[model samples]
Target: MSIEKFIQDGVTGWMSAHGEHSDIVMSTRIRLARNLTGYRFPIAFTEDDAMAVDRAASGVLLDTNQPNYSYMKMSEIPSLERLVLIEKHLISPHLANPERHGAVLLSEDETVSVMVNEEDHIRIQCIYPGLQLEDAYKKADEVDNLLESELPYAFDESFGYMTSCPSNTGTGMRASVMMHLPALTITKQIERIIPAISRLGIVVRGSYGEGSDAPGNVYQVSNQTTLGKTEQEILVDLGNITSRLIAHERQSRELLIAKSRLALENRLFRSLGTIAYARLLPNGEAARCLSDVRLGIDLGIIQDVDMSILNELMIFMQPGFLQQYAGTELSQEERDVFRAKLFRERLNIANAPASLEEDREE
Candidate 1:
């Protein structure tokens, strides 16, 4: 699909807000880091080497004869369009780098993307709505098998799949689940949970993964080490941890309702009011407000808004998506204005007051 079509269609598939634990779990992603045999890793690649790798990987994907598959080189795509791809999680920040020579092959549904000449020779990624780690891994493995059939992979009998990073040398898989833990964060339980999980070979990262901040109280929890575990083992371990997190978050939510129901309601309604009526919304403030509003919806404190709209807003509120949707480049201040307007329109807050009153009466 063309980037224009992708932007116009908005969020779908994994970002559609449907699946198990959709209230807490935003999505699950499985990424496999791989390198082709007989080539230097991407870090050492010259322009010629990078081009060759891209050609080989993109060629394999194109030759698959799947009508839904679309491939675009980073250089050929506009910088804004590239940023949109990153916002949608169709491509990574690294692949969108101007200095990097790479291309991305995407499925029409936007669930699967294979990045060529990224940190590794091939980075196969599959994302599913909510907590579907096993399903995501199944799809990713299918793509991996198809690519391995056409191109040689750097694999060792003892070490499993070979990757550019030694940490990913074993199964080359990174399984992650994105969760919105407003209750945990608000109650200050996340501070205790992060270190506890880290001890269990699990790491917590911001929404967009490593080195990014977690806006909207969203966090990405993933397995930290892949060197000693099988892919199935990694998935199982992460799944167990994710289930526990969901339980903890739900418990925390219930605790908030029991201990400070009025205060919680006030906070959520105030957030809803801010997003629905404010004329200017900064990205960070927008995220926090939306996060509270989402919590309200999940807890039956708000009923007028759909969860899917909130999910889409999580992406749309970003600078890249806001600019793309407006069909123009925006300064930081301009983006804030456009973002507020977008939120009001999407929320359709005309009946929100009645909905809020009705919810409170219950």
Candidate 2:
């Protein structure tokens, strides 16, 4: 159950699953930020203090014995392995920094991960496939409660929990959903709705969370203001907005399929062709193409493909994931070539219907 074994096992994490509603809702994640009562934030800590915090947090996670969780030091894990963990959403962006003395306790199912000595003293995260905010929150809350008994968290009566970020002060809870909104993006509606959603206190970012572009029509939407609201309120508000976005995406899909069926089909099949035949495919291009093909499968435009494979590819196609899968470092050009070959093998290009192109011609 070590991080090495977890990586070697080729686990896809929670996002790889086709959950309750896998079509548009890719995955839902709940993150809780907490700090130790006596310790300063990570930036102020000496190396020894950081290591001490790592060990203390690891001890608490191990003592819990709640399920299949394994603790490992970040220093021991390789850079590529750490990247793979980030790709799987099992660790935070800040924790990926090798200079930091930190450890992560990861659940076997990859749904739960507790980061020790990251931005805050601890970051407990629970991720589930599809739109299951309530369920995700429940799991996260269970872990938070378990740790509360053993760890003295920094809390104030006026404000609920103290965190490094001002926006996360009160509840310290961020409930977010990774949405596949290709239809919205395709119809140019996402641009309009994103600002509107932001005005409602919801923050929208690219697939990798803050400071990343939405490369595959994938966006992570979450609440920006967490201070005044309770966990339930955050979830309720996010859930309502997410449900509306899902409706809009579906409606856009139906409209495109009806109004421009030929163009939509052309785009889907062209993507499939590129995946199957291209000699070189960049990660960004692959992601965008895969998103379209996945949407096609969901809409029944393509029936022979497996949604599970596509779900898995969404993780496997990342740079770190591909490098780990290859067992070595690769240059940009090398990765592109390898990616194309890998995609063809996974897609089974030999049997992919050649008629897809013919249909476009007709």
Best candidate, TM-score-wise? 1
Lowest lDDT block of 10, candidate 1: 352-361
Which digits, one per residue and each the tens of the lDDT, describe model 1 over residues 88-196?
A: 9989999998678888988888898999988999999999999998899999999999889989899999998888888888999999999999999999999999999
* Each prediction's whole-model lDDT (CA): 0.89, 0.85
Give the TM-score comparing model 2 with the true structure, all chains together. 0.94
List TM-scores for all candidates, in order.
0.95, 0.94
Kindly report which residue stretches of model 2 are placed more than 4 angstroms away from their true locations once superposed. 351-362
Name the Cα RMSD for model 2.
5.2
Model 2, 117-146: lDDT tens digits are 888889999999888899999999999998
C-alpha displacement of 87 in model 1, angstroms? 0.8
